[model samples]
Target chain A: MAQPLKFYFDFLNQSSRALYIFLEASKIPFEAIPISMLKGEHLTGEFRDKVNRFRKLPAITDHGYQLSENVAIFRHLAREKLVPEHWYPRRQLGRSRIDEYLAWQQTNMDVACTDYFQQKWLVPYLQKTRPAENAVNVAGKQLEHTLNDFEQLFLNSRKFMMGDNISFADLSAICEIDQPKSIGYNAFQNRNKLARWYEAVRDELGPYYKDVHGEFEAKLKQSGSSNQGVAQALKQ
Target chain B: MAQPLKFYFDFLNQSSRALYIFLEASKIPFEAIPISMLKGEHLTGEFRDKVNRFRKLPAITDHGYQLSENVAIFRHLAREKLVPEHWYPRRQLGRSRIDEYLAWQQTNMDVACTDYFQQKWLVPYLQKTRPAENAVNVAGKQLEHTLNDFEQLFLNSRKFMMGDNISFADLSAICEIDQPKSIGYNAFQNRNKLARWYEAVRDELGPYYKDVHGEFEAKLKQSGSSNQGVAQALKQ
Candidate 1:
């Protein structure tokens, strides 16, 4: 008679998609509650006061213990669930490496991807306006620099970020890249190593990646007029 | 004999001070190798290529396996070394709470403090110029907003972040706040809760806090003319 793990998320978010895939792939039993970020569902009323105090997407209540932040929720599940070792392998100090990347991503990759997504897509959709050319260009440049750093620092000749296996770092990074990628950003251009690694992660993730990413794409397309406006604006 | 743990750090950095205190308090045997960030020691030569490929401060090498990033090094120590259980307790899901704070700190608290520090102190020092009023004001506003968020979201009517005992979250956060504090930012202006929590953490840490913080202060003093210039510029 214990309360089930309740996951409240919006697929528009990169962390949300990554965690959704993680939950489904790991087969952790939980209630999936979709919160519409665009509608301000997470900001107003009950969800803010009672569910997540931070009022952020990609949150969960595990047996009444409310938790926010993507990395925190991921760690909580890894500790309290039957997560496969491959996701957070301890062999050869894999967990430490993942921890390092996650920390770095929080400061670097997450910032760049989220900023690009905002300028290219989210801010425009929210404001009912076209993407600001200058802002998008600035974000694009930053994203390019960050992707280069990501390749130089994390990715090498390995099939994935953590070698032959796909860890949460790969999952997290792929979803982060998709934030900009799905918004008409060319993340893989001129970065052959990153492109190959992306494919490898996608292939490894298979259906889970496809489904969540499909939902994300659908959500993007659902913002139909916004996308069209950006396309036309950029064209002009 | 096993190779003693090697810690490369500069006390001027917040995380470096935090980890240095942790090592001393925990009685962990480590070879403290100071890398001067002001001198660009972490950026060039052997430290960049051989020590940490990421070329960051507060790095560690345990049995020749190099690790970078503050939170990663903390977790690595917790897992591999005899860090006190109180630092990362398991009872009442303290670890999860700590993890949440750490993640939040990385994105929120750490960013605001570091940004404020850079704007108010580091940038001026590096460029041999007075602190830019506009940039410092912007960073000050951000730091103020972030401090407010920190109080509302994290601190409560408890002795510490996790109630009663000091965790790594408190340690990490206190150090982060000090970055701006050491540079003359008035962090405890309005938030009584944060002020109380800050005092509690400081009192709890006692001499260990004093020593590391003293070294940090000394580093600031050693910067000499940079501080004098900022003081004069702000007055004008």
Candidate 2:
């Protein structure tokens, strides 16, 4: 028997959750190796030297080849694995469209969302202190601008990003939004089109979205409670 | 015959120059429509409404379908046009590796280069003032860190990024580095491996690199002389 693909992930990371759901939904067999970002497992030791030189979460070692970067890994799976066509459809230049969105998300949406997540949760969690009011506000403002742009540019009177089918663009985007959303950011306020599209993608993915999102929420709650404890102690 | 793949680009933009070279080198027929980023042509009016809704440079319209983002356009060309196999070779999972590099570049290298360029040249050029000393220093420090990271993470003993053959990653990266290099930044300082890799890519590319780079240099000189004038006026 051939060796299964080795996936190193942490659900607290958005790309990790996105790819995890992708692997599960696609029914690709793989060994799940969870690496905690909180513990700095991905930053040093074996994970750094042996697995991924980039030291990023949600890396994969397929057979003997190592690959990092979420979008790259997603494309690799689409090409090398038995992924269905709908996720990265070839009909009517769908792949190009998806590619465009992915590129935009990498630069714009992902940056904004990740910055917001880092300021609001990750930094506070790591430092055992309250979120920096000014930094969080700045990140929030950027996130607001990005979400508005996302809705205006990508969202429309469609069930998903690429019309009817839920592509990886939608999957990746929802997970990105969740990074801010799970930490108490209201993304859907005054944005009905975005809300409808989000609901559609959520409905389409069903259990795959629910299970991974549940794990993410659980992790966030655990962190949140501990953070509150720290806040209380700081108050004293 | 097929509308010649209308490519809206500004040579001043790195991706534009990269894709222009790719289109030329690959012999894919494209109608080169230059939109000046300096004049804010890509930001408003028909270019924004009819061409690209995103208001970004290095955009394309192929057979009536629009596409944006350099990496996406490269992939689209590879898929839809008669691009050479070596540019995005499939053997030995070369495409995956290139994809990884491109993703990393979009987030890190491209960001640093653009920021540095903006601080060092574009911002001051547009505002008709000298470069902000503090901002330039910050951006320069970032560029230095990113250059080191790029050299360590991507460059190896290979003749190119994907070994022996010049891939799009090398092409794109060289153009990105030129964004800082053209504007008087010493990218080759103490980085022997990066310098060698750059020379190899430039040599392989031959005139495709030369013609575009010359035009870029010419534009830089024009803007640079005007910037000097502004400085001289301020001195008086």
Going through the candidates in order, what fraction of the true interface contacts does each contain? 0.76, 0.80
Per-candidate RMSD vs. true structure? 2.0, 2.8
Whole-model lDDT values for every prediction: 0.89, 0.90
What tens-digit string does per-residue lDDT give for candidate 2 at B16-105? 999999999999888989888998889988987888989999999988788888899999999999999999999999999999999999
State the number of backbone clashes in model 1. Answer: 0
Per-residue lDDT for B113 in model 1? 92
* Interface residue Cα RMSD of candidate 2 after superposition: 0.5
Per-residue alpha-carbon lDDT of candidate 1 for residues A107-127, written as tens digits (9 for 90 to 100):
999999999988877787777
Candidate 2 has which clashing residue pairs, if any?
Answer: none
Candidate 2 lDDT at A141 equals 96
Local accuracy of candidate 2 as per-residue lDDT tens digits, A13-55? 9999999999999999988999999999999879988899999
